[model samples]
Target: MATATFHQSIVSFASPSSTISQCGFKIDSSLSFTSKKINFCKIKAMASVSYNNTLLSPSKTIPDNTLKKPNEAALILIRHGESLWNEKNLFTGCVDVPLTEKGVEEAIEAGKRISNIPVDVIFTSSLIRAQMTAMLAMIQHRRKKVPIILHDESEQAKTWSQVFSDETKNQSIPVIPAWQLNERMYGELQGLNKQETAERYGKQQVHEWRRSYDIPPPKGESLEMCAERAVAYFQDNIEPKLAAGKNVMIAAHGNSLRSIIMYLDKLTCQEVISLELSTGIPLLYIFKEGKFMKRGSPVGPTEAGVYAYTKRLAQYRQKLEEDSEVICS
Candidate 1:
């Protein structure tokens, strides 16, 4: 009878949900338990034990190709070769100006310098000065076969064309224009000569208007505003291409390019205001992991000719200031 009862208990335990109560057995101190029945209970208890254990482990890592090396991607920021307004020291604002004769030559030289490097993409402003410089540079670099993509708000019908006409060509170069990269709007100051403006307003006031970050000139955008717009566009559009190992170049105006550089270099408003970008010179930037690693200029620290000309202009301004001081005295 005892053996049979033990066997029944074992069978009950083997069934699903194998509850201890369902085994139809109870321990009593008054009654002496058989050794076999006791052994069966031990085995069943061992089988019913639940071990609650869990482990936390780190997730698999994704390789960051963008962070691998600075040489993986680059950005070349070139101010549009000199324009007619540039020579006259006039406020160009958003005005479309053609490049001067010397400006065209400068663009060709810039092309020669970067011809060896494989430029995967090019970006320029909608203005003619910038567009022409980009066109001239690409042609000189023997990459004119690449399609030029114009970014006019009105022109929405064009489809993406092949970078090169030759199907056999492996090289792919895309030239795109963006309005966000346009020159700073000079507002009421547009078309006025810098010297004449200084004479009309005080020299210190003109300097502050030109160099201050937050102070906008009569309905015009300030340097800080330019930086905000330019950086936003760069983060949304340009940064991804750069991360993907594309060598990008931007042909734009002085102020627009300056806005970009200020962001890339992490410069303060004051530092950005002090920066002076010469016409037609290419400023190269190396980026890694979405950060600026290094920057270089195709031309030396300063173009001697342009520097001398700027110094002469400064002297002319000083002379006017001295005359004003005497009158005030």
Candidate 2:
């Protein structure tokens, strides 16, 4: 084995082939460094992920390429970046809102984290914030394929938007927007300042409406009511794609995503009540053999767990690394 150590090293990796029109960098843009600026005799050791290839239990890991089966695919769930209403501390249920500047940056950063991972299709709520988050995140993907929305409202819309060339179709990804994935409706509370509403309605009442599993705000959808539509759409529309070995990414609202996650993890009603998700952070899962296994989130491509445990993922990373070297050269 070649012995190499990097007290500090810098390198950049890019992959154009994986993207449409050969416009992509399969590696994080931050990885680029001037080779002349650093020296390495050899690369001796690499950090191993726990349970994981390193035989350490730092993190619960996928066992021995348990995801090597062709049926296995990656499922990623991300809450939409912060919206304008979020910045204002207002209740933003199904109302269509846009992302704030910080929200846009969050989405871009999120894209960098999963740049190396494969994403064949995307799903987002019908709201503009969720769709914007999805589009912004894809802009950072090492795979630079355009994510075009599928128009299913009318048959003519679909027919009119169809790509005639198979190659163009192959290079593009379909983004499906579903109203079922929208945030839990806040009814009369929409646009109301959360703090003011809490003050007026009493903190306890607001808490029940927000955190209680089945309680609803005046004419609004409760967590349970939201889940009824969200989870049903997931099981009906999303799971089938996973079964077909397609990598799927979903950009949605907090409550809707929480509901979908609750279904995936089989959480109890009480348990789901306590679940909370931060905006713009992605949670990963492996879908195989009609089962879903949470993989936690990958913070970056350099993270050991990102490429370890799954042989196929490791191989994909290896290929990306090779392509990256060629790019830097």
> Could you say which candidate leads in TM-score?
2
lDDT of 1 by residue, 1-329 (tens): 22122112111110000001111112231012211121212322232231001001211333232322432566777877778887778877677778889889878877766554446678887687888888787776644445356444444434443234566343445677776677766656777877788899988987887777666666566665555556656766776666666677889877777777655544445445666666676766665443454334534323333113244334433443343222100
Model 1 scores a TM of 0.66
Deviation (Å) of 255 in candidate 2: 0.4
- Candidate 2 per-residue lDDT over residues 1-329, each given as its tens digit: 00011100110111000001110111222122112211110100111111123222121323222334466778988888778888888888877778889889988888888776678889998888889989888888876888999988799998998889888987788999998888877666777888888799999998898877767777566777677677767866887676666788999988888778766654546555666776787777887555566655678844667544565434433443353222100
Worst 10 residues of 1 by lDDT: 14-23
Model 2: which residue pairs collide? Answer: 3-42, 4-42, 4-43, 11-31, 11-32, 11-33, 12-32, 15-26
* Strongest candidate by lDDT: 2
Q: Against the true structure, what is each candidate's TM-score?
A: 0.66, 0.73
* Candidate 2 Cα deviation (angstroms), residue 226: 0.5
Cα deviation at 285, candidate 1, in Å, is 1.1
Candidate 1 residue 268 Cα shift, in angstroms, is 0.8
Residue 29 in model 2: shift from native, Å? Answer: 48
Model 2 stretches with alpha carbons more than 4 Å out: 1-68, 307-329
User: Looking at model 2, which ten-residue stretch has the lowest summed lDDT?
Assistant: 14-23
Q: What would you estimate as the lDDT of candidate 2?
A: 0.66
The RMSD (Cα, Å) of candidate 2 is 18.3
